[model samples]
Target: MAHMSILLLVISSLLLASTNAHDFIKYGYNGANGADKWGSLSSDFSLCSQGKQQSPININKNTTNYDSNLKQAPRNYVLTKATLINNGINIVLKYDQGAGNLTLDGKIYALTQMIWHSPSEHTIDGQSFPVELQLIHRSSDNHIAVVAILYQYGSPDAFLLQIQDELEQLAKDKCTDEQEARVPVGVVQTRALERRTRKFFRYVGSLTAPPCTEDVAWIILGKVREMTKAQAASLKAPLSAEYQSNARPAQPINGRTVQLYDELHNVKKAPSSKSD
Candidate 1:
C-alpha cells in the first residue's frame, strides 16, 4: 500500500506538470493578467517587467541618429502557402515553408509569420496610428527580427484586401477558448505588403508580450501606410473583446539608441502622423 501511494503521488505530480506545460497560464492586455502583472504571473515571464530593452517604443525623430551605412534589408517574398489562424488572442498568418527571406546584418532570416495589432504599438513622436503589422522572421540560428509597419485609416491596404475573405471566414468560426481556428489561405504574395521607403527606424528590443525575450532586431518603416476603417474592423472582429484593442502601450526607451536610415538624408521632415 505504501509503494502504491508513492507511485500515485509521482503520477499526480507528472500530470500537473504536463497540464501546465500544455496550457500556459493566460496573459492578456488588461485586468488581472494584464501587462503590469505579467512578470509575476510566471518565472518565465520575469523579463516582461524587468527587461530594460523591451519593444514597441516611441521613436522620437529628433533624438534618432542617422546611420548612412544602414541600408533597408531586402525582402525577397513570393507567393507561398499560408494559413490564417485565430489564436484566440490575435490573428496570425503563418507561412508554411516560409514566404521569403530577409538579409539583415549579414544573416538571412526566413519570413515565418505576420501578426497585427490594433491602435498601433510603436508610436512616432508620440503619435499613434490605427493599425500595425509585424512581419516576424527567424534565422537559421533561431534569432528573431521583426519588420513593423504602422497604418492610418485611408485607402484600403492591398494585402488585407487580398485576405479579406479568409479573415471573414475565420471570424465566423467559433473558436473554443484557448483553441486556434485555422483556415488555409492558399498561396499568398507578401511582396505587395512591402512599403516603398528607404527610411526606417532600427532598434534592439524584446518581444512585446509575456516572456519578453530580448535581443530582437526591430525595423519600423518610417512611412505610415494606409488602410480603410472596414479593413481595420475585419481584423478586430476575429479577436475577443479584450484583445480587440490588443496593443501593448509603448515601453520606455531606457537610453537605447534608435537609429534612422534614410537614403535621401532628409531627417528634417518627420514621418507622416495622419490619423483616421
Candidate 2:
C-alpha cells in the first residue's frame, strides 16, 4: 500500500511538472527505478524511511511591508569553497563552508552548501512566493539544518549581481550563457540581501531530493528579498530546454505542525522536466 501511495504521488508530481511554462523531467529519486532502495545504499538516510509527504504551499499571509528591524549576523559564517554546476536548466553553485560560532538565538549551527528552488517552497497563509534559497547548515552534534528564504518579485539585488558577474569565468556549459561573457542566473538571481529580518520559522523536514533524507532542521524566513521582473527573466534567459526547470516538488508533511518564528505575518513568494 505504501509503495502504491508513493507511486501515485510520483504521478501527481509528473502532472504538476506539466505546467504551461515548459516541459522538463527531473533526475534521481526513482532515477534507477526502485523507489525503496536508497536506505540500504547508505545508513545516514532516514527521510527515505520516515519522511512525511507534503506539497509546496501557497504563502498568502502578511503582504504589508513591516519594519524588518532585527539586527546582527550569526557572528560565525565563513565561505570556504564554491562548487558550480551549469546544467543548462539552472546553474547550481554550492559553497563548502565553515561556521566559527554559528548560533541561532544562541543555538550552534554550521554552514553548509546552498541550493536554489524556483517559486519558493513554504508559503504563509495561502499565497506562493517566487524564489527560495536553501542554505544547508549543521549543528554541534552534526544534524541537518536548513535556512529557507522566500523572495518576492521586486528590484534586482546588487549583492547577487556581484556574484553573477564573478561566475562568468567559471561557467562549464556554453549553451547556458548567451553572451558567453556574463555569468548565469543561478549565481546572481537567488540570494537574500536583507541583513535584518533574519528571523525564520523552524520545523523538521526532509531534503527535497532522492532518498528524501528527513534529518533536517528547517528554517523558513518570514522576511523576503526583492528582484525585478527583468532580472527574473534573465535567470531563465540562459536556461536551455534541459535546464529550464529543475526543482523538485515539496514533500508531504503528513500531520506535522508547520511552526513559525517571530511571527510578523510576513510573507511572499521551482520546476522540473517532461518525461521524455
Q: Whose lDDT is greatest here?
A: 1
Name the regions of candidate 2 deviating beyond 4 angstroms: 1-50, 53-75, 79-81, 87-90, 96-101, 167-194, 233-240, 263-276
Candidate 2, residues 1-276: lDDT per residue as tens digits? 999999998986664432111112233233442234444443333444565642343333343223344223343454344555444444445553442334564567766556566656566665566667777666767666677777788887564565554444443336423222223334222223324343555556766554465546665666677876555544544455543444554445565555544423334210112100
Q: Going through the candidates in order, what is the number of backbone clashes in each?
A: 0, 28
- Candidate 1: segments with Cα more than 4 A from true spot: 1-23, 266-276
Superposition error at 5 for model 1 (Å): 18
Give all TM-scores, in the order shown: 0.87, 0.59
- Residue-wise C-alpha lDDT for candidate 1, range 96-139, written one tens digit per residue: 88688888988999999999999899999899999999999989
Predicted structure 1: lDDT: 0.84
lDDT of each: 0.84, 0.50
